[model samples]
Target: MSTATPAHSSAQSGTAAIQSATIETRDWLIAAAAAIVALIALYAVFMDNGSLISATGDYLHEFAHDGRHLFGAPCH
Candidate 1:
């Protein structure tokens, strides 16, 4: 009879792979949550029209930033 460790087909291999996948998925979820929170905070800060208008000028400043072609002169 052969005498080998018989580790070529071990259950631990599949378990390790599953654990690695779970860890990777958790990392992605955390990163996504952080990004979403950051976006929300930014939106709250910029959504105040009065503040934005006072900071710059004109309430339409935010929209104009998207494209300068609409305005008569190029944006600074």
Candidate 2:
């Protein structure tokens, strides 16, 4: 009185596997950290005006300034 096939069992198992899949906390933490780093890099490249790295002298400022000009960002 059983009509279950091998293909039907495999399909059920695949659905179960998909339903069991979960995004762990570590994955979320890594994503958050990456976003933070990207934000910091963007800030350093575009918005930094010696206020962020003032103690390091104008080296970083000039570097970012030149980078801006290279990208045609109009810094002056």
Candidate 3:
């Protein structure tokens, strides 16, 4: 007698099984560090107002003036 299995017993194609993903502490730390750096850059670009990096006259101000208007942050 033949011992072949039925066609319905085969695995499905194209679709993958679900998985449970977890974030470790190191991953969170890296993400937080990147976020902090991005925030500092954003501050320098939009809300600097020549307070933190404006020691050399209006260089920073002038440099980011067009950017301020483009972002609608109001530098005037």
Candidate 4:
């Protein structure tokens, strides 16, 4: 919540725009939080210098990131 809001308040603005924005924010927050958690878990898994499974997960995540970057989305 910003201290300075736009001129269009809930009363003046329609409900649809507000609802959509709220939903989008919720989705973005969820995605961001999940990504962060994934990173932290990955770090923890590799903390002991990693077992085979941990190393495999790290490689898989790197591969997934590379693929996403190449295609511009999770699977293009």
Maximum-lDDT candidate? 2
Q: List the residue pairs that clash in candidate 3.
A: none
Tens-place lDDT digits, model 1, residues 1-76: 1334446445677788999999999999999999999886554344434453466554454564444445333444
Q: What is the TM-score of each candidate against the true structure?
A: 0.50, 0.57, 0.60, 0.43
Better by TM-score, candidate 4 or 3:
3
lDDT of 3: 0.69
Worst 10 residues of 1 by lDDT: 67-76
Q: Which run of 10 residues does model 3 get worst, by summed lDDT?
A: 12-21
Residue 16 of model 2: what lDDT?
A: 79
lDDT of each: 0.60, 0.76, 0.69, 0.61
**For residues 1-76, what per-residue lDDT tens digits would candidate 3 score against the true structure?**
1344433333322122211123355678899999999998887787786776547456666799998999898788
- Per-residue lDDT tens digits for candidate 4, residues 3-49, read 44564465457677788899999999999999999887754433322
Q: Candidate 4, clashing residue pairs? A: none
Compared with the true structure, model 2 gives a TM-score of: 0.57
Best-to-worst order by lDDT is 2, 3, 4, 1
* Model with the higher lDDT, candidate 2 or 4: 2
Q: Which ten residues in a row have the lowest lDDT in candidate 2?
A: 17-26
